[model samples]
Target: MRFIDSHCHLDFDELADNLTKYMSDALASGITQFVVPGISLAQSKSLLAFSQKHPSCHISFGLHPYFLTAHSRDEMALLADLAEQNSEQLVAIGECGIDSQCDDLELQQALFKSHIVLANRLGLPMIVHHRQSHHLIAQAFKQTPPQFGGVIHAFSGSLQQAQYYLKLGFKLGLGGTITYPRAKKTREVVSRLPLSSFVLETDAPSMPVFGFQGQINVPVRLIDIFAQVCQLRNESEDEIAQALYATSCRVFSI
Candidate 1:
């Protein structure tokens, strides 16, 4: 089956330790492409070197909300400059979004808005890192919609929430969460949402699949996630694979 892992952190310690091996494993599993998101200014800059080495891995640079302490007051300006300087080498403008559980929700929203504006200006899509702040995210999107559209990475929301993102031209990212038997809501959303409104992601070295919990996740687990998605949907494996590949390509224009 053809697949593209729309989100993966190949620069992270666990995966980057022996990236060549993991990359080989992913390629052998029929996964064609991988999108690596920027979690901070330093990490994003670090990714530049990785991109030069791995042409098959695409990059997107932005600050993640969870690491707000790593960001400075002029962080958005710096991120904008970095994004512009390496615009040609990047695919989207994320892993940025607000997480309600964090105390700095307001600050995260401000940064997210800046990210939205930057993405719109660059005509690039986004790889939004959403959590328990769907209303906040949807509100941000509704206020300043993304012109190139993006994916809600590691999506785990209701069908109504899923429809909201789909309506705004964004696609829901299906990851390891759906593999669990306890993910009934996410599974139900997967089973119900239109095939075109989704993309596959591993968020690797992070979101390990069901049986592999506590292990370092990798892009190859995308195949297992894809298998679960096929079971959740009515489409055949080939049909699901083709549609998901097309959606992944379209979302990032990679």
Candidate 2:
């Protein structure tokens, strides 16, 4: 079964070194495509360089809520320019969204809005990052629905929230979160979610699978996540794989 890691941080130093080795292993393990998201303008530059080096790696440009202070108006403008300049190279408009845990909620909301607007203008999808702020994201969707749709990466939200995003034309990104036994709610949601509403991701160097928690995440682990997904759902391996592959392709316009 072929797969795509809908989210990963291949530009991070930990993964960047010997990236070729990791990419080789991931390809061997059946993960054929990857989407690397940007949190800062600098990271986006590095990500673009990496994407240029690797044909299978696609990129998304956006400012993460956690790094809100790191970038200013100029950087935001730079991101928009980069998106416009590299329209064909970009797959989405984010890794951007509200994180309730962060300070300056108002600022985060404004930044997120800009990202959504840019995405809509660019006619590209987005890769949203949500943590304790589904209501804010839902509210934004109500105000201005995604023009090209998007994905809620590393989603561990309730089925109700999943349905809300699905209603807004967003796909749920399933990753290592489903591998943990304590994630009963998310696992159950995954079990029943429509295949079309789901996409696979590893969030490499971050959301490691249950047993490999301390280890740095790599795209090759997409296979193990897929194993857990298979256990939770009724679909056959080939069916699940094909659906996920098509969903990623459709959402990102790859």
Candidate 3:
């Protein structure tokens, strides 16, 4: 039952305060590896430090759409420089992409494009953060596609949208959100999507599952997500786990 959380914010406040204990718990719960995504420059350093301290942890550095205000014109250059200098340490380029929920659609798209270019140049996967803007994100992909395809972290979209990303050679990140009964569309997409195009994630300190309502999410809870996904797809736990592990290895090159 070994597993990998393809996306998480381990540098986030909820997990940062006691990462050692959290990592221990996650290990006990079968999460052997994790990918910590950066939201801004500050978070990127924090993620790097965490990964440096923990052998099982990996890092992805980029500016998130939600934190568009924090980005500067030179930030992309800095990110590219950091990627080149620490290419071995960094696994991918993201928690970055478009989010229409935030007002700055144009700016977010611009920054996302910059990240795509950087990822292509560096030959690293791009972990996309699409929210209420899949169409726009798809359009951006068309303009400047990724060389090393990545996942749509915490996907919540229609089956058609899932197909689009699959056609583009991107994996869909499945997390606790699909555990909720109200996530009908997401569950449908999950059931219909091929196992090869799916990867597990927690997005820890957010997107908590049903039973852990009101509590901060964590990688250990990915087991619950795995079980839910198994039930939805009517597959055995071992089958789902192995498929997801293979999918993650393909996406992250681990």
Candidate 4:
């Protein structure tokens, strides 16, 4: 069955330099399309260049919270201008959101709010990144729901949090995080959630699967994540695969 990696950092050096090699492995493993997210302006440019070279690559442009300090007012303006100019080139509006584990909660919130506004304005979905800041992100969704709903990438939240996003018309991105037996809570939530509300991702170059911890994750590992998802859910592999492929397509318009 064919698959799509709904979230990945193919712009990173490790993956970018060896894209042909990893992409070959990924294709062999059934990953046909990749949604590459931009964490900063520079990275977004790299993603654009990469996409130019690979037709299978889709893009998400945003200012990630982790790199908050690196952004400035000029950067934000440029981001908006770039989005307006290259709207057709993007599938979503993020890689942006609050991270409770990080400092400057207020700044993170402000940046996230701006991104949500941008998503709405651009009429595109968003790929949100959340850690311990579910409440804040949920509140943002409640206040200004996205017109083009997106996914909570790498979701490891409770059923309630997952439902909160679903209620806001979002899908949960299942990735390597679910492969670990230690992630019982997330795994259990994945088992119970509606298949329509789920999408598969690998978050490549990070979030490696259980046995490959500390190693750079690759898009091909999306197959292993899909296997864990199949084990968690009651659907057959083909059913799960089709459902996730459709979900990613619907969310990202890929």
Please list the C-alpha lDDT of all candidates, in the order they appear: 0.89, 0.89, 0.86, 0.87
- Candidate 3 per-residue lDDT, tens place, 109-161, comes to 88899999988887889899988889899899999988788999999999999
For residues 1-254, write the lDDT of model 2, one tens digit per residue: 78999999887888867888999999998888999998988888777778878889899898988888845557888999988998888989988999998888888887888899999999999999999898998888778778788899899889998998898788999999999999999998999889898999999989999999799999999999999999998989999999999999999988
Worst 10 residues of 4 by lDDT: 68-77
Clashing pairs in 4: none
Residue-by-residue lDDT tens digits, candidate 4, 1-254: 99999998887887767889999999998899999998987787677788999889999888888787745446767887888889999999989988988878887787787788889999999999999888898787777767777989899989888888898788999988899999999999989988999999999999999999999999999999989988888889999999999889888887
Tell me each candidate's TM-score: 0.97, 0.97, 0.96, 0.97
CA deviation > 4 Å runs, candidate 2 = none
* Per-residue error (Å), model 1, residue 229: 0.6
Report the Cα lDDT for residue 253, model 3.
83
Task: Flag regions of model 3 displaced more than 4 Å.
Answer: none
Report the error of model 3 at residue 52, Å. Answer: 1.3
Tens digits of per-residue lDDT for model 1, 1-254? 77899999988888767888999999999997999999888898888998888888899989898777745448888999999998998899998998988767778888899999999988898889877889999898878888888989999989898888887788999999999999999999999878998999999999999999989998899999998998998988999999999999888887
Q: Which sections of candidate 1 miss by over 4 Å? A: none
